[model samples]
Target: MAIEKIMGTETELGISAKDPRGFDPVSGSILLINAHRPIAEVKSIWDYTGENPLLDARGFEVSGERERPSQQDNRTINKLLRNGGRLYVDGAHPEYSTPECTNARDVVCYEKAGERIFELCLASANLSLPERQQIFIYKNNSDGKGNSYGHHENYLVDRRVPFDQIVQGLAPFLVTRLIFAGAGKVGVENGGERCDFQISQRADFFETFIGLDTMAKRPIINTRDEPHAD
Candidate 1:
């Protein structure tokens, strides 16, 4: 029998601050997440006891220091939502991850909810600041510069399937789906072809066919095997 496919989405929202002294995205992200009011009191902290991003699905562990933020910073940067979701800061962007869903409709519903949550957070965050230093958030994937953030999709697959076979099957679909599914961008970046506009905002940043790095040298099919569940 085939395993059931559980799906979810993780979006890293673009953050900016209207400050004359320039902006710090990390600080802005921290403020944005901290401004949201949870459905109930946040009694427990987010557990990171089992997360190991270096563990690759290709059957090997990469050498690197896993990011473990200080408890104080973690408390300030993370928010648990009532809709079984998470709001937090990922790198320089405020990110939200919807709870695992069994269908596409619920996934999209939760993703849209995340945007509204950010809007409320943005309003609350701006109230505490001067009019000139207010913060803003964008739902897009790129910053229009060389930097690109992520809007990752997750699907629970059968562990019995070969990893190589999975990549081979998914790569073609992922590459070609941009023709219809792309978000559409105004201009190009990363020194790729000079076009007035492009279908996908992230296509220029893809350099490798497969890898584990999300920030740089991004892969078409990432191999990070940190499943949040057992």
Candidate 2:
């Protein structure tokens, strides 16, 4: 069956930007929203490293309140896959260990707690001007105890601007914003401490979501009284 052929789905709805609603149908940029209720955490039973569950490493439960995301990234990706959808990996979300992404063109890491993450590509052959999809999955490294992670979002600016300038310009704007996917830690940096973040940065997004790539991958920490929005 043609993927374009509409399939009746209660959980699915398509919209043309030119419709009566103010949604813009521009080909260059489009936002595909997953309206489904996202899980608060990823529960798992397998222990990847057979290490003692009581190991006190740098990422060992930062706080008793559970400092990291509890949900495993694979589960979220698997769910999207079952729904016939995928995500983008790029430099924005890279593998753990050598977290820094040399490809300036790809998305990158700024901050991370587990120092590990998973990457995926939902869009076909990079982002085209017309329509494309990109999904990024961040999995908190787990040796068993309580863990955490976030499904951060990245917008590929296809405009013809210098990557360095873009990185500098986008940072300030991003530091002040949050994503609708959900709330999580944010920062700016090329690869903060390796796979421990989205974009290595000098500051963190405090309590707000969305980290600016001001310093390439580092994110500033934001703290304010503004009513939070998810």
Candidate 3:
């Protein structure tokens, strides 16, 4: 049987207000996103009727609290762009999720579009702010203060594939692929380590071999299974 794949990218942009006395990432993110008027229409409510995050790929569901948010809570941060992408605030950072792409090349194009969207929003938002109250957004993850943001990718894999087989075959590739796939970083965190330059900014932060936590105890390969568009 041939396997079909659909892929997309999600990025949480690092944001900060330039004011030293008062810095608010949440507000900064809101301003940055709202600056793009079209994204302001991202107030659509998310349907979470059958969603499950704790469901593992191993045919067992874990017990955990999964609270669904109302339209108000979600509408404030989410914007569905005409290009089929999404722009919104996830926690304190501005996030952009590309629309479903059938292949890697299309994924790249949409992801680049997301960046241009952010840049346009930033420029517009800065025009409304005071000269000293500018906002800065970084493409890289981590703030060099033990805080880590995320740039996650999602792909559609065949559910027929065995979980063990997927992990076994994919894990090694993920680990070594950083040699060419990394975004590069200066210095290091997670253990006070110092480096002139590193291939991947996210490499030293993986404290656990296998886990679902993306912020605290980072994992090389996330096991949380979600059947997208199911």
TM-score, cand. 2: 0.22
lDDT for each residue of candidate 3 in 31-75, tens digit (9 for 90 to 100): 788788773464455566777778776667788888577777666
Minimum summed lDDT over a 10-residue window in model 2 is located at 5-14
Score each candidate by Cα lDDT: 0.88, 0.28, 0.81
Under the 3 Å rule for N, CA and C atoms, how many clashes does model 1 have? 0
lDDT of 2 by residue, 20-102 (tens): 24434222111222122333422332222332323222223222221222346333222232222232222222222222232
lDDT of 1 by residue, 77-177 (tens): 88877788899988888999999999999999999999899889899999999988998788888888788988999999877889999999999999999
Model 3: CA > 4 A from native: 39-44
Each prediction's TM-score against the native? 0.96, 0.22, 0.90
Who wins the lDDT comparison?
1
Q: Give the distance in Å from residue 3's predicted Cα in candidate 3 to where it truly belongs.
A: 3.4
| True-structure RMSD, every candidate | 1.3, 19.9, 2.2
* lDDT at residue 11 of model 3 (Cα atoms): 94
Ranking by TM-score: 1, 3, 2
